[model samples]
Target chain A: MAFSLDTVIYMDNNATTRIAPEVLDAMMPYLSDYYGNPSSMHTFGGQVGEAVTQARQSVADLLGADPGEIVFTSCGTESDSTAIFSALRTYPEKNHVVTTRVEHPAVKNLCDNLETLTGRKYHISRLPVAEDGTLDIERYKECLTDETAIVSVMWANNETGVLFPVEEMAKIAKERGILFHTDAVQAVGKIPINLKDSTIDMLSLSGHKLHAPKGIGVLYVRKGTPFVPFLNGGHQEKGRRGGTENVASIIGLGKACELAAAMMDEENTRVRALRDKLEKGLLSSVPKAILNGHPEKRLPNTANISFEYVEGEAILLMMNQHNICASSGSACTSGSLEPSHVLRAMGVPFTAAHGSIRFSLSVYNTEEEVDFILEKMPPIIARLRELSPFWEED
Target chain B: MWEYTDKVQEHFTNPKNVGEIKNASGTGNVGSIACGDALRLTIQVDENDIITDAKFKTFGCASAIASSSMLTEMLKGMKLEDAKNLTNDDIAQALGGLPKEKMHCSVMGREALEAAIADYTGVMLPMAQGEVVCECFGVTDLEIIRAIKENSLASVEEITNFTKAGGGCGKCEGRLAALLVESTDKQSSPATAQKKKKRMTALEKIKKIEEVIEREIKPTLKKDDGDIQLIDVDGDFVTVSLRGTCAGCYSSQTTLKEYVEKKLREQVLDTLIVEEDK
Candidate 1:
């Protein structure tokens, strides 16, 4: 692990992160000698059940919710689907949903596929965003109506890191008696979220995004909200979600949540400073490099920069030579010929959209790594510009 | 992440002939800034009709640049006629292979080569004169058809991969799907020779009727000191109104029943009926 870390500079934390050491240490026993089924009527299984309860409490504490409100699932996608389908099934009469135009595919695709899933047509109001990738609350409020069943929005955009006013949106949605759900997969660990005071009906978060192992996720459903089971099997998760508990990953996620709560300050301060420095250095050194997303209202860890007249895949390949890792919003990288939906929805021009790069930092990132990226990026952009047909000498 | 080949990586990193050949015999430019990938290829031909030198300046992703570079390398010292016959698959094969999604990069190279050849010979390629299918990218039906024929593309998605025809807005997917069937049907066995004409769903009929009225009818009417508006469509019946000079014209009914219905039937559906809204 030490040797691997020395050679690689990973900045694509929003995509996925390396599991934290503490999370792994806490999960090792579950993966080894403590592999008892939590549901068995035996002392060994009883001990495992106790550990599972403790893990649920840890996750609940991180979100400032009651432990009973938490339902463990397979992944963020599953959690999102569960929360959304539950609301749809509970209010079968309602045929409308409100969501943002720029959503992670988890919520966006599910909303898009609602008609096919339920065998009934749905009217979906997709709220558009501004040029800065931020939504207008007025437009959102206008979309909510009496026929609306649920309002699903992302807390932070995966590509742009633009934060939405989900709390305020949820409040507005609640007044209309509509269930509000936020896919906070990218926001939970990076920012402070106190669901206890919020009007949000349901929240979904994935473990891998927050430095826990993959295949673990949490859906926080406020008590007394109308609910339906997405997965039906032997009573598990209070019959809210069914499947045997993913013991090791559940333990890891609990530890990861605890660590996230403890390190929230460092993530906001040091990581935010490093991200700003990286952004400033690249903007100053590289000509025609503009930042994507809202400048002030964004996640601290993410910096999406677009270097015009140069393709993102070429820039990423060039960066690969220096052992630097990042992600792109370019269509070429996504196996499609258009840039990310978020960038396109924000009206990012073709040149910039084709060349946008997303650098997502984490608590593990260091200032030295930031400096190394700042040093290596300018020449990469310059070299790509030299080959670009649109580049001018000025 | 795309699992690009070593040769693709090599050419992407150390691309060959990365400049313009000024005063060249022929130059072919394809794509645009709005299209996300553009190529400007210049070639110099000798008296023997041999390409003596070739160079390109590209604005696209890694595969696009590599395809341009590979096309130039393949064009150098080659006969003009042979270069004209060079396929996009050849360009991809020369660089081991490109990702399936990036095949359009190679197609762009082939297009630029054809455009350059046309520039030299002063002959417009048949595809260049064909009807534009995708207005977002200015991709023509002949171009999409040729790519579909050459690549044996089976779906709209594959056509997008090869020629970028339906990659934008996606208003042309139904058209592309029809074209895909048309091209593939020609290659099928006699047992499956019965051509299946696409039946438009109700939603599709409404969209197509509106599009025809807006795109084909309204503009022409407005040009003749007249205007037209589509009121609604219920099944085969189309309700419209002629405004401006047409509202009081003596031949307005004849224009509606004959010209308007004829154009709508030809462009959208054959069973359409025209009735002016009273």
Candidate 2:
């Protein structure tokens, strides 16, 4: 199966997406002709500030937030850091944080090193997930206490696409007077988000996860939320974030958000159907294959399947041979000796955890591409099973 | 992604001799699913003690599968005695070269081969008799020491890269560091004893100190954005200045005594004393 690069099928949108053509078109002028410092006093640069304001408004509209609440940052990690750090800074006497065990490294690592980073000993309650990768709200409620400063959880897991009850969790934390943050990097555009109806105080989103360029992100800080600036510089972002505006990527993100809003319906209907087709085809065709996350509470365009008795790196490399792109949670793929922390926290067995593959589709994926994957995957699994020591004939 | 060699990609894409041989003379299975990679190797030895046929089945990453395939290809028609002497380095060399982190794959191949040979001879393997140092991969002290000696490994990071000893929960890192020092001490003792018989002149001592500082000490410091310059060599006291991030660092004294001085003592003369220049 010799395929040209032009015909490559991409299904790793959770890792990153191809920049949308509309977004590129919107950003071209900003990159070449409209190159101006948004902080400059002159109108030439002041005009760029207007575009930034519009982008902020567009982002807020998508999230059902006020433009004043949106603080543009470098990326999702920066947003996550800023949100958590701001909460910690707001309540210095509080020494406890509530989070989930299956968080992305951006949030997980920050929570792990909070004591070292802040020079104060802090207790972290990392709430565990169930076998199907859903959080227990009862357990989440039990973790919050008077000493808890904030609760941080991801809206959707990047590896399994498992959706957490972040809204309910946020409401519970709000009743306790604790700040709540959600890393919505994977969930922002894939699912419906109305932050106005929700109790989440802060939310983090990355531009590249959608069809926008990288290096742009948004941290939604609710109005009147006690805040401290992570990066203190000039009065850019009203002194919230102190960096020169990433003029072009910010504009591109705005265009991408507008496009995502219009395509959300198709994302949940058409793209989700393709994901289901691919998932069902692989699980039914490949023996001993199992679904990794919650069957229905997951992202619409994501499927994580584990082909037992095989290694994920081998599966991914074989998939690469067919110009099919995906990601894996195997220890070998990550250069760590342990499998994905998310899968492990969900109690996924080693037999499946070592071979988990995540296919995160985007609106750009076609049914034909899904069919092509279905056609190519069974043989690939069979070939690898033939070479696997633990694989048994059914 | 790993920068796999063309040969590694070739073997992984189209692996040869992939299967289990029925009623084989000897069969060896190493690793497990929980550890993320495993290999089962079988060999058929003729009456002449030559491996007539060899095949393998592996559950692992591309490098592991490629290593097993390359090992089987290298094993076919080789004498049992020659196979006994084969090291993991030989398997890696045969496959062009594996990534430093993926070297454990070749190590797995060698272990499977050794187990197979032990089964053929009905002898218990000595490497298996040692205490398990890395519970994650079930690697033993004997295996760790052998990897260190064979590969000239210097750090815990390298041990993890080669044998996967401290790659897991890393509870065994302290044990691995002790084992490393034990192995390197044993390796250098004989040479140290031999060198102790001769007394070096002042010029020779200074030259040897300078060489060690440049070749051994500088690179290690530079990794941490630090540098060292040899200032003076008076008798056994070698004066050096720590530059860059090492300058004015609170842990510089510990680095000087534990790392720089220890390295100088091992590579140059055991009596050499290193002092930070005031």
TM-score of chain A of 1: 0.98
Q: Write the per-residue lDDT of candidate 1 for residues A234-351, one digit (tens) a residue.
A: 7889988878999999999999999999999999999999999999999998889999999989999999999998888889989988889999988778665678889988999988
Clashes of 1: 0
lDDT per model vs. reference: 0.88, 0.90
Residue B223 shift from truth in candidate 1, angstroms: 31
What's the chain B TM-score of candidate 2?
Answer: 0.67
Candidate 1: true interface contacts recovered: 0.59
For model 1, report DockQ.
0.32
Give model 1's TM-score versus the native structure. Answer: 0.87
Q: How far is A182's C-alpha from truth in model 1 (Å)? A: 0.3
Worst 10 residues of 2 chain B by lDDT: B189-198
lDDT of 2 by residue, B1-278 (tens): 78899999999999999998999999999999999999999999999999999999999999999999999999999999999999999999999999999999999999999999999999999889776767778887788888998999999999999998889877678778877887788664322322333334467768888898888889999999999999877545677889999976767767887898888898877866676653
